[model samples]
Target: MTERSRHLSVHVDRPVAEVYAFASDPANLPLWAPGLGGPLVHEDGAWSVLTPHGRARLEMTPLNEHGVLDHVVTTPSGERVHVPLRVVADGAGSEVVFTLRRAPGTSEEEFEQDAERVNADLALLKQVVEAGAAGGAGGPAGA
Candidate 1:
């Protein structure tokens, strides 16, 4: 089966290092990614979150200088999913991109939905980071 990936990127009006610093911190997940950002509990070498679907475990990449934010998400049914994320320098600002893969046997609708979700999350990330860079607290995006 050929693997297909969809990329969604957002430009944040902040330095690449600053953006990576904030995004690489798992603690800030809830501030930008509301969907997957819940209270995380570490148990048995994995971070667990009570997702609406069920209990899910996430293993994200450690803080690194290469701007890699990949993560492994395991569902309650024991399915392991890999999500590739990156942050790169874009002139005076930063560009954050998320790669969503279309799993084998996944329906087209499901893939589109996944892309939409990622887009919304990226938008939130851009808003939060830009707001902080503008000397404002992390308020609602576009507020």
Candidate 2:
């Protein structure tokens, strides 16, 4: 197998829309994602955020109640890889699951390392939304 992937899951105790809205909206990313410090820069629906590690460019494509944020990130060694955010609603809240797959020729260890970071980020996301941050139209700020 040339590619290796890992999936991580977390349950957020907010309404599905609330969780979805906050996580999908680029502007609110920085608030929930402390590890990805600073504000998010969006252009043509793509968001660029600076993290403790460096920078990540996300291509957001949102549909009615479903969306995916395609991520382009540079590893410590400066190699670029593509990751996807598959967001789906579950009952009252949302179950966010991230699948991390390595590019062809990349090793599983590298993919796991990256996936760990992604998992940690999602864990933080769950904490933020479940702790009562996600609420209204433009997120908690507008609430």
Candidate 3:
């Protein structure tokens, strides 16, 4: 069986570095990506959150100048899901792209629901970033 994927993107009225700085911080996940669930807790040199599926561990890529926000979520059942995210320069603004992939045995309806959730998350991200930009803050918490 072939896996399917959807690339959802949103435009933020901020520089790539600013957007990356905000979105790259796990502490800001609750502000935009609420689908990930409650606040992130940093423990034992790792970040974990209380997701709908229970506690899940998150491993994000190190901060870099390349604008890569890739992360892996280890589900309660020990399923490691890779989420590919990026912030690319779009003129003076930036475009955030998130790739949502269909897992094996997932139904079409489930995939569509996932896509919708991602779209909503991206929209929220745009609003938060733009609002912060308007406030003269380079990024979230001035990061």
- Taking the tens digit of each residue's C-alpha lDDT, what string does model 2 give over 1-143? 43556777787766666776777776777766555555567776556766667666655554344445555655435666565665555666667878766678767777776677777889889898888877665322221
Write down the lDDT of every candidate, Cα atoms only: 0.79, 0.65, 0.85
Q: Which candidate is the best by lDDT?
A: 3
Model 1: residue 120 alpha-carbon error in angstroms: 0.4
The C-alpha TM-scores of every prediction are: 0.84, 0.69, 0.90
Which pairs clash inside model 2? none
lDDT by residue (1-143, candidate 1, tens digit) is 43698889999888777788788776678778876747777777767787877888888897676788899999889988888999887878888999888989889998898788888999989998888833422311221
Q: Per-candidate RMSD vs. true structure? A: 5.7, 5.1, 3.5
Q: Score residue 46 of candidate 2 by CA lDDT.
A: 59
lDDT of 3 by residue, 29-128 (tens): 8889997777789998999999777899999998777788999999999988999999888878989999999999999999999999999999999999
Candidate 1, residue 128: lDDT: 86
Better of 2 and 3 by lDDT: 3
Model 3 is weakest, by summed lDDT over 10 consecutive residues, at: 134-143
Q: Model 1, stretches more than 4 Å misplaced?
A: 42-45, 133-143
lDDT of 2: 0.65
